[model samples]
Target: MKDVEDNGLKNDAFLAAAASELEQMVEQICERIGTPLHETTELQRQVLAAFGFGAVYSITHRDRLTEPQAHALSIRMLIKPFNYSEQQAVDFVDDLIRVASNEEVHPLMNTIIHRGINGHVQFAQEDYEAMGRNIQEILAAVQQ
Candidate 1:
């Protein structure tokens, strides 16, 4: 019981910190790119949907799910909420990982961090550009 409580606290802290950092990064990227973040686009919607599942499942599973597990959960989420075909959901998640994180292995595939109940977000640089390149690419892809 004690261990469960402690672990829950730890994961909550980690997720909160991740979210805050991600928010700041988004703002900085937008500022550097000379545009606000795109809030309503297909890609954005899909990512939000995936992250929404992350937000909930991260709490429910709590350091128990792997990236593949998180990903499988996301597929179901996208399908139900967005009414995406199974293949579309898979592609959306895959494209999300590729275009956003520039990763290959199931995104968080093997991290002990949050038991992979996390997104593989990469702000590769924190310069005058404020990591705008990645954001720019995403915007371009989604035509935002």
Candidate 2:
């Protein structure tokens, strides 16, 4: 019993350290990408958090996400914040879902991380541009 308790404590400590290290890596990536460390937007934070959770969950619960389940989750993540129509989101999700079940498994983590960051940047950039246009249109309509 004592041995089991000690092992559990050790496992908890290891997880804590790993979590800390992952945060540090994310901070470094943000700095390297020229994004302000202290000024992260809520959307950016949420995206990162979601990716982190997804990675951990995918790894730990590998069997739970069947092909359809994984595809659905990806679709939901991709479309929740964007102005994409449901059909458009579904199409994009369908196209991108193959990455999760690719044959190459060893480099999956790196691929996932890269894809997540790229997707976040692409969506956020486009969303910001669209929002600006919408705001401008609203202002012009108001003035007229």
Q: lDDT tens digits, residues 9-113, model 1?
A: 976575555445435543554465574445445655543444444343544365465576557655655565456799998887675555335434445322212
Candidate 2 global Cα RMSD: 13.5
Q: Write the per-residue lDDT of candidate 2 for residues 1-144, one digit (tens) a residue.
A: 999999778655644443443354345445544465346555454334334334333432433444544454444434433334679767755433443445254243335444444433433354434333332342233346
Number of the top lDDT candidate: 1
User: C-alpha displacement of 83 in model 2, angstroms?
Assistant: 26
lDDT of 2 at 48: 47
The alpha-carbon deviation from the true structure for residue 41 of candidate 1, after best TM-score superposition, in angstroms, is: 5.5
Candidate 1 Cα lDDT to native = 0.49
